[model samples]
Target: MSTISVREFSYNPSAVFARVEKGEAVQVTRHGNVIAILLPGSGPVARYADLVAQGKIRLKAATSADRARLPHYEVPADVSPLDLLLAEREEDDR
Candidate 1:
């Protein structure tokens, strides 16, 4: 792990970028207050797979119709699927 002031990161971004490229985490501070972190993103699926491989999490498989038609559960016919889809799309863009 490494710590760098926001000023240092701003003045010489390559140095912080190099540390991130090496898979080292970094903490960035502004006015002595922790503001952000820098890390390499290798994609969510691969990272999730690695976590499952390391037993950090458990995996599950669900059958079709288990959702929207489970015995005690159901999706209302009038449910607004479009609204949910739009929200998810906005989150993905973020």
Candidate 2:
């Protein structure tokens, strides 16, 4: 498996897909944190356990029910997520 930053994935998605097409696994990271994995669907699904053991992919953290549940956030309609995040950072700095 190969690791790629989010920026690199964004810069060339086709290239990443090409790697998977060649039966290579790809791990996508953000800020040095693993966020997702791209696996070749044509590969045997049974080998997923082996991949997980090898740390090629993180185990599922959420169940189907968790995914089906909608998350509701109470925020002003005009507040941008970036602004909210920045405000939280400012508060942390204090």
Q: How high is each candidate's TM-score?
A: 0.43, 0.49
Best by lDDT: 2
lDDT, each prediction? 0.63, 0.75
Stretches of candidate 2 off by over 4 Å are: 44-94
Residues 1-94, candidate 1: write the lDDT tens digits: 3678988999999988886675555668998875766655553233555564455764343234544475342447787777766776899999
Task: Give candidate 1's TM-score.
Answer: 0.43
Candidate 2, after superposition: displacement of residue 65 in Å?
42
Query: Which pairs in model 1 have colliding backbones?
Result: none
lDDT of 1 at 83: 74
Candidate 1 ranges beyond 4 A from true positions: 43-94
lDDT tens digits, residue span 1-92, model 2: 67899999999999999977866667799999988878776764336856765777664443447557955556789889778878878999
